[model samples]
Target: MRVLFASTRGSGHFHPLIPFIDACTARGDDVLVVAPPGLEASLAAREQPYRIGGEPPRDELTRVMKRVLELAPDEGVSLMTTEVFGRLGVAAMLPALEEVCRTWRPDLVLHEAYEFASVVAAERQGIAHARVAVSAARFSRSTDALLATVLEPYGPGITERLRTSPYLTRLPASLDPSPYAVTHRYHEPSRPGALPDRWGGSAEPLVYITLGTEAGAMPTATALYRAVLEAVSGLPVRILLTAGRGTDLRGLGPLPPHAHVEAWVPQADVLGSASLVVCHGGSGTVFGALAAGVPLVCVPLFADQPANARLVAGAGAGLAVTPTGGPADDSAVLGPDDVSRIRSAAELLLKDPSYRARAGRLADEMRATTPCRELIGTLDPHS
Candidate 1:
């Protein structure tokens, strides 16, 4: 069997596809990938390449994203879904992607959510394709809407086909259960690295802070970071904050004595010993924290982040600070009270054992998920 994998660029989006790709290669299937020049280089795939580079022009994407960022977090998802990922993405990726499908003629095209070109190309070429979920379950409606709107010109039932296709996800059923009938829930196959105990058996808890790579580029995230640092100040626990590469460290000013900032961390390693996590509620971070059984203080920046935050809070695994136009109380919109809430929430999570207990339960669910390697037979044509 031959499989082609497609996804948006970035670690968060790209990492979820690893399980499927690794499964295909482990079974001796030939594979090709369409993605940014990052870890995909390490993926085992066929040598011949497709130069699939038609991302929206930088200026236009920037102009559109400017408007997207300006809108209240709730108002932007539609525009982001319709334009950025839908219209622009289709125009940019479809031609070259379709050519790849026609040329390579793989038996299957597996894609991560938020990437539609591969699905369309597979439909056009009459090849089988499946989608892997990269976030919480609430996305299918908006995602289905986006595909329906973009796929009209190509053919009928393309959207419906995707809506009912085999779905794969790493999200535990407790987080956001899949609505799909043919869903396969599983954990990624890679083993987590060991975390070296810096304290050498000292009893102090470790708090992990990561706002995700995209956060570094956003000014809103800068303010959120400062607020989180200030909020956690004077706490007995030690803090390790991973400031993504794009963040303006100078803009963050001085850090509290208990907190140490870095460009990145071995996330799985850090989470191994972390007692609590403060993050932007990205799927990867939220998922990682849950898998590690670490509680969270989620301050959503945009997109599905707020949903992930609410999920964590609702599940009793963490607290969420979301946006509102109110004069006081709310994050990203109103200011100081948000920090107070974060502090209060963090304190509550640290002191009470319930939150950690709930998180541990979720972690058990995560580990119990069927291994991705076992599901490959379902997609493998030779089987």
Candidate 2:
């Protein structure tokens, strides 16, 4: 069967589907991607071609996002749902997705969770579709309301159709915020690489730091990065920091003796032996660290990050640091106050055994979850 995959214009939206894409192609199923223009290169890097969707009105989205940054967290999030994902996203993607579905004649549409346009197109085309969660669960409290508002134009029952539709969730029940009908265990893929000679046996505890590629471009993240560097400085633990290519490190001056910096590295390779992880609470990073049984110090930057961080903290696998003083999009810097929290959190994670133990239990739960192949099989037309 021919399957069409749809995602927003970011690595977080696209990368989660990589393993599933590999699985589908291995089984000789046809696959195609419908996404925004900037993602073509990413798809090409994966040796896949894609159909381009119209770019969202960036200026208007930015204006609304600026407004979102001012409101209370919950209010901001609800506005973001209504304005950004629900309205702008649907407006940009639905036309192209509808055209693609019409021409491609896909039997199924598998889309990133926030890509609601695909569901609309799928319903309009009378094709089966599933929502693929980027993280362990849905982050926003406004999802149902947002869907209702945006899908109202599509007529009745569309919102119910979306709410009751299939979802491909990577996280287990323990970590998932909402109940999911289908679960697919997450596997962090890595390239073949040589490990350091003394990797896992190092006497000094290894701390891995990353804020994800998307965070590197944010001003708030730059402040967070500086705070992290200072917090870990002169600490006994050894640090490996992977700032993305978008982060300009030239002005950061000399690094601390305990910390080593790189533009990017294979996270799965480094995570295998990490003693602690310091990051921006991205779902992939959070899950990867937990899967490796490493405790975390999560400094959330934006979007779903704060929610993810709270989940980790609530799960007792990590500590959440709110250095921004208010909303993440505010100009609030990660000041000296944050350093103490970071250092304390890291030290506690290293000294205490409970955090690691909780992580281990979660890892085991994730391991026992069903693989994506099994879940994908449920989509088979012939089945």
- The candidate that wins on lDDT is 1
Best by TM-score: 2
Model 1 Cα shift for residue 379 (angstroms): 1.3
CA deviation > 4 Å runs, candidate 1: 36-51, 196-202, 323-334
What's the residue-level lDDT of 214 in candidate 1? Answer: 76
Candidate 2 minimal-lDDT segment of 10 residues: 183-192
lDDT of 1 by residue, 1-383 (tens): 88888877666777788767777778787778876334344443534333443788889988989999889776687777778877787778887788889998889888887788888899988888888887786665555665677777778888888887788887788778777878888886445787655444556788888888777667676776777887787688888888887787777798776677877777888988789998889988998889888999998878889888989999999999774423644345436777788778889999999999999999899889888877767776556
What range of 10 consecutive residues in model 1 has the weakest lDDT sum?
A: 41-50
* lDDT by residue (tens digit), candidate 2, 1-383: 78889988878878777777777777778898888876878877775557889877779978897898777766776787777778888889899999988888888888887777888888988888877777655673245656787877876788877767776766667876565444444453345364463334446888888999787777666666777888877578888888888888775678776677788877777887688999989877887787667889998866778888988899999899976452456555676677778888988899999999998898888767666766677777668
Instruction: Write down the RMSD of candidate 2 (Cα, Å).
Output: 2.9
Q: For model 2, what is the alpha-carbon lDDT of residue 87?
A: 85
TM-score of 2: 0.91
